[model samples]
Target: MELNYVISITDRDQIQELAALFQSLELNMGLAMLGKGTATSEQLSIYGLSNTEKAIVSTVADGESARQLFRAAKRKLFMDIPGNGIMLTVPIKSVGGGRTLAYLTGNKTPAGGAPDMNFEHELIIAVLNEGYSDAVMDAARTAGAGGGTVLHARGTGTKQAEKFFGVSLAEEKDILYIVATAQQKAAIMTAINKTTGAGTKAGAICFSLPVSQVIGLRKMDDN
Candidate 1:
């Protein structure tokens, strides 16, 4: 089974509705909301963080259940809505346990495909300004970053981003998420800063996590 990791773009005020939407789909609200996305400054617009009002991230079931949720979302909410985010899915191979899988998918009937509970590498999560994913990715390559996922996004905030390192700001942005080894994090971040530091549009903030488990990545193996 596969999972749809829907990063629903919207504003903080709209979180309730988004939450309700997820609840309706019986999906898990993974890290559902940004820690401090309400304020423009906290929104991190160097990468166009200002263009995004807020985002609601969730993982939903696949197969019939996934299809049902998408149909419902399209019929009920994804129309004429300005700034509504995009929905995409990544396949999960297996889970740590039935309970863990249920929590991750919000109890949606599993097609028996959750993320594998065992893996050799760590998964890094980098949240940064948009429009600079290219630069970030280049840096990651230099830093021994195995590879990464790039998602285009609009960072919110018109007033908060007056001058980041003495530069005017834009209202939209992009985000590059990379999963790298524990040893390579430093090089990747350094490479990204070289391009986006004070003069470029891709300035970013990066962080990482140890992968408890993962699945479906023959491509990752070649790396």
Candidate 2:
């Protein structure tokens, strides 16, 4: 079966409802993180989003179940309506081992196949030192990125991480998520790396993921 990593971002007030929705869908292994939207006042107005705390929820599911979850979220939570939330799925290429795969997939048989690559947009994720989100967002904006979400996080094994990445890393981190068009991904990533990457105060590490499906960004698309 094809596996997908599903991510949902919504207002903090809606987290409980979203969690119950996930439970009804059997997406039990999900995690929720507190985050804040990075949109400016004007941008927030344009997107019909209020300046409120956000929740970032993620989970793994088979392709079919992922689709079902998306549909249910749209119908039950009005996720398709602007200001409700956004949901997206990224294809999972592989997992660790048999038992690991079974646990993630709920014991479904594993299958190997080429990932779908015909997506028009991708999700760019950046990990940076805490309090450096402003610098990262500034760089990203220069490369045509509109807005992003910032999640506060704590890191482990920093000593080893510093040796591997050749840069000092703090335990406190900020994970920034930017969804941009495929055409904009490279430039945004390059800009971020040049301005905030290793050796810089931000010391950011950036990467991209294929977004097989997404919703609640009609305003972005219209722009």
Candidate 3:
């Protein structure tokens, strides 16, 4: 079985509407995260750059479900409201992380059995440092990745430092996402870790998910 995730990045004002749109299409909202501009403001202020606000909404779903939601959004929302939003889907391999399996799919139903995220196919996931956009792209490209989305994010639970390491960590961050194949996953991660993780301070992180099924994107051409 392949698992797939539909991730949406938008401003605070659009979250509710986006949620409703997804819900209408039968995809359950799994997790939601905020994007504070504090760090961006600080970093930009240092160089006199302006700041912008954003948020991320991630949903777990099957390929058919994802396609339906995409169509709904496009027809209902027009999807080009000038910074209103962007939505995409990535394939995941497994869901053996936590109690999440049962939690995410209330029916305890498999992807095929219950539209509850049976994965339906296989895909890759890459986690990397906040700022290494270029490195992420380069590495993904090496593994047949044509493009990925950039998500503004922040680290949580920082009450630790300010003590042990004496290192004041900036909570603001950025996460780049690339969805490729089970075959391309490993190479992309290795390229990212080797170049961004080792050579730079981006502190790159990488991982993958098996995708069960997919919709649209006859153009992405997974190499």
How does model 1 score by TM-score?
Answer: 0.43
lDDT of 2 by residue, 65-173 (tens): 8989889888888988867878998988887888888888778776668677779889999999999998999899999987788999887646876887766545788
- What stretches of model 3 exceed 4 Å from their correct place? 1-5, 8-17, 25-56, 60-125, 156-171, 216-223
Estimate every model's Cα lDDT from 0 to 1.
0.52, 0.86, 0.57
For candidate 1, give the lDDT of residue 149.
49
Q: Which of candidates 1 and 2 is the stronger one according to TM-score?
A: 2
lDDT of 1 by residue, 1-223 (tens): 5554444434456566656766776665544545222222432443344534445455546555556655665666662232243333444555689887678766767454455534344554554565556566666666665444455555554454555343333545555555444556667777776765545665565555444323322233544
User: In what order do the candidates fall by TM-score, top score first?
Assistant: 2, 3, 1
Which segments of candidate 1 are over 4 A away from where they belong?
28-30, 35-52, 79-82, 104-223
TM-scores, each model vs. reference? 0.43, 0.88, 0.53
On residues 52-114, what C-alpha lDDT tens digit does candidate 3 reach at each position?
A: 565667787655667777777667655534234556666655677556665444434564532
Tell me which residue pairs clash in candidate 2.
Answer: none
Highest lDDT: which candidate?
2
